[model samples]
Target: MKKIKITILFLALLQTFSAVAQSSKIKNLENQREQIKKEIIEINNLLSSNKKEKNLTFRDLEILAAKINIKERLIKINNDQINLLNADIKSNEIKSEELKLENENVRKDYASMIFNSYKSRLKESRIMFLLSSSTFLEAFKRSQYFSQFSDDRKKYSNKILKNLTSLDSINKILKDKIVNKEDLIKSNNAEKRDLSNERNNKNNALSSLKRKENAYKRQINQKQRQADLLDKEIDKLIKEAIRLSNENKKSSTFSLTPEAKALAESFTKNKGNLPWPVERGAIIQKFGLQPHPVVRTTKIKSNGIVIATTKDANVRSVFEGVVLSILKFKGSNLTVLIKHGNYISAYKNLSKVFVEKGDNIDALQIIGEAYTNINDNKTTLQFSIFNNTTPLDPYLWIAK
Candidate 1:
């Protein structure tokens, strides 16, 4: 029965667009920041375990560099949250001011009506007003008028009360927003401190690494040859698989059954949404060419992403497909290839194989345990997905 609803309709309509959009954007950013923070913690723990090594290995530099990258991103996210909270605080302050003005106007009107009502009641008592009517019908109309007038006054009074309540609610919300913004500022400052510490550690690591230039170059060269060999072997095995698939058919690539074709379609549809090959690993090496994280002049290229994990971590299948072949490099163990119609996913550097070459595997199924190198005291998985013999960047298909 309060006209406050009508008065505030415009304000409500104006906020509709930003309400969900701003809240959800902030929530999404916060979630991402938390995930990256957890990853930094994991990487820190992993790197700390290797601190007792006689030398600061290139792998150590890589891990430290990765941590620095995440820390930088984390700081950026914190700043973004603070910016968002500031915008929200400003928006709420404006809305609160509007509500205050509206409340004031409503109170003025209610007070005027109350004053006028008292004057009328004093000038003409209800019984006197009713008896003053010339006829019975007129007296009955007069009584109805008085009743309606009382109801109108009560309704306006209620409106004023409702407006006051809304103003109070707005004030409360503004206070809460101010408090939240303060909390965010504190968090942002704390992250900035942590970032500073990481940067210092990075500088120390870089200085130590620069002292062993030749040793570092040798490590880089060795790793590059291994990667090149792995790539060659992967190409060879996948080409053979495609050849076998096309052996009986006129198709240049694999001739698929209807079900296999459908499965491939589904897998393609889930690009950027596919599960990661390993549950708990950070992508130590990314797809495509980039300057090495530690060695600025040196370039590193990867057809697929390399995920570093705990020793003997589970290497899971990204999609359901039949295993094609399990090949091995000289040092690294078996690498399993799975075929889903025209698409193939490769999981390399595996220590122990779980499924056979011809076994039917489901999505997220554990294909093998990643290799643990006693020399470096590390475990890593080189995961690649292919469309026939052509390599695809594994990062594109995997979930964030």
Candidate 2:
């Protein structure tokens, strides 16, 4: 009985841990799904609305591809949840069988105990047995035995009832798990269908893009030139900034004053604590080299990340800085360069500017609103961070 109870307790604990683990994983996957969903929603709400907003550009195709990929991943997670449920149900079924068998054995043992006790009492009544004692000491011993026998019978009956109760509880839990498992399967199938539909949508978008291959290539070239021009201008401005910083000190490096050094150190320490340039947007184009979304063989180099945001959305500084320059080039939106000690953060593609050169700005201060390209039907901000003229990956510096 002790071993059987220990086994049941161990199984119960194991089941609890297994269930908790599966629940945690499922919860984590659900959270990831929600985040992706939010990103999709933001993209759709902020972009892809105008008549020119068909799936004709890389950004549009990228969004569709991302949506399909996320849905597929969501389906995979649902399947994983269903698999875990199936596994748990099967394991519990085995445990339930073992418990039922043990309960039956306990019932039999309890009946045998009762029968033996009855037989002993019938053969020699308790009073008669006490009276049959040869002496006082013998009577005393027989009386103690009678009491112990009664207590043992009560204990045996209680143990049998407890085992039966446990068995019933296990059976109920198993039934519940089975029902839950069925529900998970249904949800899994639904997600799979959703995934299939997403894939179909992706195919349709890709087909639309494929139809305009030549025109799309020319558009890509034009956009690439624009990006290259932006990069060059930003680079030139940063070099000029570095030169200016070093001019007074007659050195190639920035001469940090006491306050400047402290601020620089603080900014360095908060590498992953900086806020985003826009409050709500998705990083459509990440920093560094990326393959074209439709033309896989074509490569594009980016000095910064492009955030697609709502039209006229305010662009804010990620950190405290002094405005160094506001660059305006033909065929490009306004760009603001702000310096924080030896570091510089650049906000580009603005329809309006609120800050001027030499303005001291606080963290998350709105410098300008993002530019909305009327012809392209796009609204986005290009953000860059530099450590003294050296480009740093913006993602490493921004909060997730």
Candidate 3:
């Protein structure tokens, strides 16, 4: 019986810890859902206010598609949360039932012990028991037996009280978990409804944009050329940096400066913990091949990374490095490339520049302010990282 009570107590504590962990995960999911909702609202406002033939460029369509995708992801997360909460609630209910049964057994044992002890302690019973002894030795043995019986009774009573306290605590914890589950269910339902509305809005916006293909194609071509030119300039700078790095080698082995080496080490150490370059943003284009959202038959490839953010957000350095080049595009924006040991990080589409060629930059240092499209009020930064011209997926490096 003692072993059984101890086992029950241990299981109860474990269940309490599991509940806490689940609650934390639910809170994090809720926060992310809220952010997605805000982005959807921003997109809706942009779609409704503009009446100038809808420009309806490829970039505009891409932004709307990304918003819709985020909304869908949010809905899935909500459903998952609901399912998990329901499971937890059921588990807690089962645990509560077990606790109740254990408590009842403890109470019954305690009551039985109390009744037996009372019967043994009666005045008539005690006198009869003493007189029944045949000799002095027998009487002495009888006294010892009474003493042992009294001690056993007291111990049993104490054990029952302790079990009762534990049962009370477990019951309270289970009750709280039940309430939490109900709250989570309500929240999930609300988020699901909001996501459905956003999806509908996105469908409407996509339909309107699909009607203006000629103007959209022109815009896409111009943007593609701009992107290509930026890519070439970045490649040239990377080759130059690599050559300089090689020339400065000692004895046939390449060596980076102490500062550059330290930056590289720090950046590597924060592989999965580095923050995004933009302060407030979402990833519009992922790192690999994806079907074009608007052109169902077409596929789009992203070499580096594309982050969509609020207007005028400053692009910051991910780690300490030296500025390699600041290339001016044909339009109004500039692109800054920084070199950290053999690694390269590029920040493009900046209307204003704070860092220049040959300037030393520290981690999280501001390189430039990102440009916002006046027509759509959309701000984005094209960020990329390379290892001697070999592009790496920035998504894998940034913190989730």
Regions of candidate 1 where Cα sits further than 4 Å from its true position: 1-14, 130-148, 225-229, 232-256, 265-275, 329-333, 387-400
Better candidate number, 1 or 2, judged by lDDT: 1
Top candidate by lDDT: 1
Segments of candidate 2 deviating more than 4 angstroms? 1-19, 43-48, 51-58, 128-202, 205-211, 218-290, 300-306, 316-348, 353-367, 382-400
Instruction: Write down the worst ten-residue block by lDDT for model 2.
Output: 46-55
Candidate with the greatest TM-score versus the true structure: 1
Q: TM-score each candidate.
A: 0.83, 0.66, 0.76
Deviation of model 3 at 37, angstroms: 5.5
Q: Tens digit of lDDT per residue, candidate 2, span 1-400? A: 9999999999989978977987788677666657656766776665456334543665566655555555566667667766766776677678778867776877787788788878887898778888998999999998898788788778877876787787788678778867876876787688678768766866776776686777777877787899789778877777776677677444445667788788888899999879989999876676898787556677877788878787789999988878989999877889999988888888888989999999999999999999987766678898998887778899788874
Predicted candidate 3 versus true structure: per-residue lDDT over 1-400, tens digit per residue:
9999999999979878987888788778777667667656655554444334446555666766777777777777777777766777677667667767876876787788778768777745766787889998998898888898778777767776776776677667767767866776776677668767766766776677666766765665566577777777778777766666778443322257787678677878888677778776767777666676656555556667788776688899987888988888675378888888767888888888898889998888988999988766667788888876877899788776
Q: Record all residue pairs in model 2 with backbone atoms less than 3 Å apart, i.e. clashing.
A: none
After superposition of all CA atoms, the RMSD between model 3 and the true structure is 4.8
Error of 1 at 337 (Å): 2.0
Measured with C-alpha atoms, the lDDT of residue 398 in candidate 2 is: 83
Pairs with backbone N, CA or C atoms under 3 Å apart (clashes), candidate 1: none
TM-score of 3: 0.76
Q: Order of all candidates by lDDT, from best down to worst?
A: 1, 2, 3
